[model samples]
Target: MLHVNARGMKCPWPALRAARAMREADAILIEADDPIAPSELEALAQQQGWDFAALDACRFSLRRAA
Candidate 1:
């Protein structure tokens, strides 16, 4: 598992960082206090065909398919 704290990070940075980390992980857990992070990450996961679940309003988990 990989954990990322993107609480104050904005836009593509969070998503980009998450994507990069996910590339080397089987699963990724991310936390972002910013409102845009959830949706942006969701879209990125969808576009990449990764499995995702929102743990709460500001937390999300994603898993790469093998």
Candidate 2:
């Protein structure tokens, strides 16, 4: 699993980082403290057909569609 630490970053930044990682990784764990990160990341996963899970309020895991 790839790990992306986007803490202290805002909305699109966190999601963008995750998306970039998805291109090369099968699974990614992103940590973003922004209040909107969860929803934004979830939307990205939904659109891309990846599995989305909230490991916690500030952490998310995304897996590539199989």
Candidate 3:
């Protein structure tokens, strides 16, 4: 598991960092206060067929599909 802090990051930055971490992780949990985090990550997960769950308004978790 990997945790990414994107509280102050802008769009693309959080997504980009998360993507980088995804390369090395089987699963990742991303925490971002940004409003765009969920949408952006949702699209990415959908495109990749990754499993994702929104923990709350500002936190989400992604798991690699088996």
lDDT of 3 by residue, 4-66 (tens): 888898887777877888899988889887788899988888888889889998788888889
Higher-TM-score candidate among 2 and 3? 2
TM-score of predicted structure 3: 0.91
- In the order shown, what is each candidate's alpha-carbon RMSD? 1.1, 0.6, 0.9
Best by TM-score: 2
TM-score winner between candidates 1 and 2: 2
Computed on alpha carbons, the lDDT of every model, listed in order, comes to 0.88, 0.96, 0.85
Q: Number of clashing residue pairs in every model?
A: 0, 0, 0
Over 4 Å off, model 1:
none
Model 3 weakest 10-residue run by lDDT: 12-21
lDDT of the structure predicted as candidate 2: 0.96
Off by over 4 Å in 3: none
Q: lDDT for model 1, on a 0 to 1 scale?
A: 0.88
* TM-score of each model, in listed order: 0.90, 0.96, 0.91
* Consecutive 10-residue window with the lowest summed lDDT within model 1: 6-15
